[model samples]
Structures are given as C-alpha cells and as structure tokens.
Target: MWFQNANSPIMEYLLFFHDVTFLLILIIAIAVFFFFELIFMPTDPHRFLIDNQSIEFIWTLTPCIVLLMLAIPSLQLLYLTDEAHGVLKSFKAIGHQWYWSYEWGQELIFDAYMTSIPYRLLDVDNRIKAEMAIPMSVYVSSTDVLHCWTIPVLGVKVDAVPGRLNQIFFSLNRPGIFFGQCSEICGSNHSFMPISLESMV
Candidate 1:
C-alpha cells in the first residue's frame, strides 16, 4: 500500500502533496519517453536539430520552476507538521524492551502490551485514548534502545532515544482505532511492539 488512510489534517496534506508529486512525475516521464521516441525514430521530423538553445533553456527553466513549486509547498507543510501550538493535552511514551508505557499527566499511567487476541500483533492491552480534533502532544523516549513511535494515519513519527525525548504533535480527525508499531530496529521481537490509539469525539 502507498499509504494508510489519512485520519489527520497533516496526513491529508501529505496525501495531497503525494498526489501532486506523482502527477508531476507521470507527466515528466511521458514527456521524456515521447522525446526519446522522437529522437530515435527512423522517420523523425526534427532530424536536423543538433542543438536547440531554446529547448535547452526551456527544459532547464521548467525544472527549476517545477522544483520551486514543489519546494514552496513542501516547506510550508514541513513547518505546519513541526508546529505545535495550543496543545490541549500532552502524554509521555516510554519505550521499554518490547512494550510502550504511556503517562497521562501524573495520575494515569499504563503499559500497552501486545495482545494475541483481537488484531493479533496490531492490538494492545491498553490503548492511548484521546479526544478527536484536539491538538495533543506526545513525548517519546526509550529506556534501553532506540525505537520509533509512529502512527501512519496520523502522520506522526518521533524517535525514542535513551536519555533524550522527542516530541510529536497531532490531532485525530475521526473516531476509530489506529494501529502502529515500533519502526526502528530495537531488538528481538521488535515487530511485536505495537502501538494502538483510540480516538474519541
């Protein structure tokens, strides 16, 4: 699959960008193929065209313009994804050997262990629950080794390094159960350490 279903505003933006980029790539590929066919064909019309300064200038300038077009929105989305403002709640996720421990404020704390039932490795005993459409932040850190807390639908990924906390901010757009796993290669049973989130309205 190219991407999981987008359930957050940031993921929507990312999908839009991906579509535009794919369209641009398709158009460029076709144009290049057409040009190659025209050049190699036995009965070519522009056979005498050895050097065309205008064509060269156009190809160069067109790529520059296309790059600028991609870069502007790319930078804008980068800023938007990195921006964490007006966060209503915050949670701390600590990565252990093969499980995730979440702390909500100082009172509520729980460990999300991979469960065999339900969704198998994708399910967990305890899920991180939060309200939908409300901006929330998560501080991720590791206790033993490196790990990555990633939720594809939410377009949130943060590295969990020992002694260092990496934060990610996102808001769920819909109410459902979203699943993820530790992306980094931590150790044995890395694939078993799954993350699940329950977004509520």
Candidate 2:
C-alpha cells in the first residue's frame, strides 16, 4: 500500500507536509553520503578542499531559504489546526480505566468499549455523526489516571488528564468511518479502548 489513508482536510495537509519533509531529508542524506565518500577516497588530491567563501555562503544561505519555505506552510497548518472559529457543536469525552464516555451537549451520552472479536471498526454504544466541513469542538478529560483521546484520520490527539480539561477542534472532509486508540498507557486494558468517528455528509 502507498500509506495510511487520510480522511480529513487537516490530515491531507499533514500528509503533504510529511511527504515534503521526507523528500528533503532524503536529499540531504544522499548528499552527505556522497560528500563522505569523496572525503575518504584514497586517490583524492584534496585540492578543492580549501575554504571557499562562495561555497560556504551558498551552503549556509540555502538551508536558511529552505527552512523559511517550510516554515511558512508549517506555521499556517499549525494555526489552521488550532483554529476553532466556526465551531457549532461541542462534545465532551471522559476517559476511564478501560472505556471512554462521550457527551454531546445534554442530549446524548454513551460509553464506548472494546469488542471481544477482531473487526474492521471499533464498537461504541453510540456512534456520533459529524457533518462535513463543519467544525466541532471536543473537550477531553479523564476520570481516573491518564488516558488519551485520539483520532488519527482527523489529526487529533489530546491527553485526558485528571482534573485537567483539554480541548481539540476538527472537521471532517467527507463521510466515512475513522478509527483510533488510546495513545497513552493507562492500565492493563489500555489496548481495548478504541475510538471511532462516523462522519456524515
């Protein structure tokens, strides 16, 4: 397979950034390997090894320019991810030892637990629907110990710390089922707590 699938717009941007950075690192690694080979060559005269100001300047300035280019998009994505300007609905998630409970306002609330058998998707007492391109704010907290509320496809990972509330905002780009799991080590049944989001158009 090419890579893990991306569902949301934020995930798409993240995947793009990952690919760009990976290519840049690969190029730098190959160039460094070639430089080392030339340095350790036995028949090398080393005549061009002298300090050249132009070459030094170009090398230094090139990295700065490349970093600036990356920084622009990097910062933009960061702000976009953090922005919850148009959020219409708010949800709350409470993490427990081996299960997760979600509350949507005061109208709906349910607990999610792991299934006994292997399946394509996770099991939840209630499956929340999120509209496409509509921002939603999710507040996460923990009832005991520490847990994490995460959704990989939406690029959301918030720690559920006791007495501390962490919030994250996300919007889905299309209708699909997305899955995640507790990213933190909370307890023995940490592997059982799976998160699933059903995005609807």
Candidate 3:
C-alpha cells in the first residue's frame, strides 16, 4: 500500500522528485549524525568543540544549496502541472454528504455512488464518453461541506469548498479504470463514497 504506481506524467515527475529529496535528506541526516558522534566522543583532548567557523559555514551553505536544488524543480513542476494549457475536456464535480455529482462540459450531469461490485468496463467507458472528452479539466466544489477530491495514481487532488471552485488538469496516460475517493471527512458515510474514472480513447 505504501508503494506508489504512477499512471501519468505528473505522477511520474512527482515520484522522481520525492525520491531525489528523500535521498538528499537521508545523506544530510547521516552526515550530521556522524559529525555529532565525532564531537561527543572525541579522541583528542585538544579538539575544538566551540569555535569552528568553517564547519558552521559548511553546514549553513550545504542546506541552502540543498533547498535550492529541491525548490527549483518544485516550482517548475507546480506551474507545469497546474495550468491545463491545451485542455480539450472539462468537468465539474460537486461533493454532497456522502456522494459525488459530476457535470460534463457537454451539459450531461449525474451522481456517482460507490459500491463493492465493479461495473462492466465497456459500459463504464461508454457512459463517461457520452459526457466528457479526453485529457479532462475538472472543477471541484462542495454542495454541503468541505471535501477533497483525490486520485493518487493520477497525481490530482483539490479541495471542494462551498461556493468555491478548485480546478485540476490531468490527462490519462492510457485507457483503464482508475479509482479515488473523497479525501476529506464530510459525513458518516464518507468512506462509502468512492470515485471511479473510466478514461476512453
């Protein structure tokens, strides 16, 4: 469950960035622990513990450099992933107490309720295609309380607030079944309200 299988370009980039940051953090942590070990049990009695300007500079500058390395790519990904420059499909998702209602750009609207049993793939795709186009742009909002629309593999999540529209843009890497759920706790049946996306070619 902890492992992530990325399904889109945004998700792939996010996973790569996470690994890079984790590696950098691990290296820094190990180096700092080693330095502390040396200080705590120094073999030389004359080893200076207080007045090390060079060591201080190195620690400070190293963190700044690391931050820069992480920040630059993060900012780039933020802009690149956020704006749907060439979005062809559009949708609106509204959150209710325990279910989700979706409206397509073509004016088709419906409510989706979760179930343990899976629907036929062809039927699901046909229904979705009757409403939306590929590479969708989704707008989110809540009808009652706050909710979070999240699809982990797709690398898309946005808040659904009352009277407020939050948007996310994503393209399906391939045609398949993707699942998600309301990330926010809105009501008693929140767990039952799952999301299913059937992307068509």
Query: lDDT of each structure?
Result: 0.93, 0.84, 0.77
lDDT of 2 by residue, 71-175 (tens): 999999999888877888889999999888999888788898776444533656555677878888999999999999988888888999999999888888788
Model 3 lDDT per residue over 60-148, tens place: 89889989999999999999788786778688888898888889766588888665455532112212331223567889999899999
Ranking by lDDT: 1, 2, 3
- Better model by TM-score: candidate 2 vs candidate 3: 2
Where model 2 places Cα greater than 4 Å from the true spot, the runs are 42-45, 117-121
Per-residue accuracy of model 1 over 1-201 as CA lDDT, tens digit each: 279899999999999999999999999999999988888788876755659888778878999999999999999999999899799999999999999999998999999999998998899999999999999999999999999999999999889999998888999999999999999999988999999999998
Model 1 steric clash pairs: none
The candidate that wins on TM-score is 1
Off by over 4 Å in 3: 45-50, 119-133
| Candidate 1 vs candidate 2, lDDT winner | 1
lDDT (C-alpha) at residue 138 in model 1: 93
